[model samples]
Target: MSSQRSSKTFLQLKYGEALDTAATKKSITSLLSSHDGTEVIHHCLKEGARWGMSPDSEEPNTLEAVYILSGKLKLHRPNEGSFLEAGDFLAGQPVSEFIVLTALEDSEFLYITSNPVFHYYSSDTRNLEMLAIEIEKKDGYTADHCFRIKELSMLVGEKMELNSESLQKLHFGALLHDIGKTEVPESILLKPAKLDEEEWTIMKEHTRYGATILRKTNITHFILAAEVVEQHHERYDGSGYPKGLRRDEICLEAAIVGLVDSYDAMTSERIYSKARSKESALTEIKQLRGIKYHPEVVDYFLSVIE
Candidate 1:
């Protein structure tokens, strides 16, 4: 509900000057036109790109009609999946289940919706970005930590040949992994020595906090990031907090973030621990491969940083 129909009766938007715009690595969305809560959007997706929407009960009554203007697509929903092609149309709302569209090839589409979603999505992304900045500044030991993690995670994702959409989710997941730490006390966050058992327990709750913060946004990308944030601490050997998921039970994106986070934390200065040399860190990571981190993630990450 961030945008409303303008008072003016008529308007014109040039091809290059869209009303609103947003993009990810695999797709670009342009708010080409709007009228009385109805939004006409233009989407260009790279081959194999994917878009997902999860159920949200708090959302206003909303519906969407998508017309595939060009190329092929596949629709995936609970217990059903179908293919789409040029001129095909589908309409529905994610009221109680998840919906996903995957581009079978380079494609273009028109998405007409009763909800003016672009504004809300754009606003949420901006606000969350600002929040990430604030969170980073709040933690003295984590200066630029999120940024470094994001960069490293992307490299590993690329080395592993993850698609664009997966990479985008990994990007935000790594950048906001520590957002839950905002709830921790400053005394504990800035403590000069190692944390006691109680403080460690509280610190471990940051993953849950980060997941909750993201889910509250009700945005698809954030929802994916929330999963990664929550599970990033879980070890491959099933020794982790909040959940004991191991190996394939963990999200691949979360596994990547966890590995990169460990390496970065090992090499970065912290109040309680001295920075380890990069060689020492890699050696330690090698020693723990398939035990603390996913085996494949460790292989690619070591190759990337090497």
Candidate 2:
């Protein structure tokens, strides 16, 4: 297992390579490009002082560790803005109102927390390694499934011209949509044949289970991600469940996830059924477009596979 210190060093090295320029007018946007992997674990970045203010509604209880790598920043809490210089390290129980503002010169900082207020990024190597370990532990196939679905979903999202931020959410959401299945019964999940009605009902609960699990993280992105997990099983015509949300009732991110998830399920070999050829799966998806899946999403997937 990687130690916290090693993880921090890895993050620092990655961040440096992406944001080392000293002369340019650096903003949160520039900083984010270097810290893309970490974004899934954190929420939005505040650029300069223009809009990087913290939430003021309620005080947070989790702890946050901030390590400054370069330049300077004014840390604003409810009462004051404290100036923090490079090489400074601060740790505090989460405050309801806390924000960071970068100085005119380029600045860098690392934010770490166990609470789920932001997104965490994992590179392909990390994701694959984690999946391998999960498989070794005999957890299930969900992790491996997530990895492929994320790749396919991103491909479709890019072809559809989704903005960078939305694309990132879609990618992470796909990986996590079935995370709730962790609460499901292993026998039902790995059954070699079809599920009985009772088993099917239990299986369906995975969505709600996933959402609930993510909600405990207290991260805003996971909140959005939770919604995706809850609604990924919902159908366009209002026949799907937990909630039978219809049409635009479902979030766009959830819809993207739903489409890719279905595609993967149909195309991949499972314990219950043999995998369909990609062509056959595409044909089925095309036939169900608009009724079962979003038409635009279907079109994008087709374009990519073609």
Candidate 3:
């Protein structure tokens, strides 16, 4: 099942490519993943630096996601607005003749670009992010639940030796897995009270709704993510989910997310439950084994946790 690991390439943003040479500049960009016209990049920007997203450049039509990897910087509307600290993601298309960046300090970013899908999925992708923020606002404990799931899912994905495309899909799948929850009524979503059987049934439909939303968005690349979203609540033993999918029937990414989702659920406090100790959570996960999760996935998850 192993494939040739994609080569990671280093690239320099030219005078007008990523940095406005006319303005102050110092920056570096690395290519992380590229498939189906999308490129994932790692960018490092230094102090007193200014970068440009000129609509007249080589890759001008690119849709980009800039996630601050480290350090801090003031960024918003090329020359206007406030600072965005590390961990914040800025997504958009080139809106002005030249959108420039001024670094308040040395900063790094993770950029995801897809010339094709960016046009269609850009707004939706960012919208989902906003929804995630709303979820955190509604439940403070889940401040970065989607991000955590993406991180943990990627960790498991790497352990499984997933190819670059799979990893990318897994990453998106993990991030938007809970987007369907947006449809759930706030009265039930933020009830702070035990949900009755009907409510529980409605809650379980989030997976189905999530899958539908991903597909309906016309994000062709996200079809994989759609599958993961739907199957994430499924069990290896044919018990979990709206579909009762069993072993091997569920996609690998879904299984990975399912295991981690449960792990995180057990270890993190939420509107419905209190957090379990790490050891206690791990113990419960271990006990589930072949019952709740895929055996190989469980083994890999256990190995990573230990």
What total of clashing residue pairs does each candidate reach? 0, 15, 0
TM-score of each: 0.64, 0.58, 0.63
How many residue pairs of model 1 clash at the backbone?
0
For residues 85-199, write the lDDT of model 3, one tens digit per residue: 7888766653223233446788887767565332332344556656765665574355567666866886677667665445555766887788788788877778888889999
Q: Can you write out model 2's per-residue Cα lDDT over 129-201, one digit (the tens) per residue?
A: 3433353224334435655676577667655656433544564477577777668777887776778999999
C-alpha lDDT (0 to 100) for residue 67 of candidate 3: 81
Query: lDDT of each structure?
Result: 0.71, 0.57, 0.66
Best candidate, TM-score-wise? 1
Span of 10 residues, lowest total lDDT, candidate 1: 6-15
lDDT of 1 by residue, 1-306 (tens): 112222101111111222123232456778999999888988887775555444445554667677899988776543445788999987766334444566779888887877667665445554555566566666654545666687689678766767544655686688788888778787786777788999999888989999999887655667767989999999999998669889999999999999998898889886567899999999999999999899999999988899
Q: Whole-model lDDT, candidate 2?
A: 0.57
Q: Which TM-score value belongs to model 3?
A: 0.63
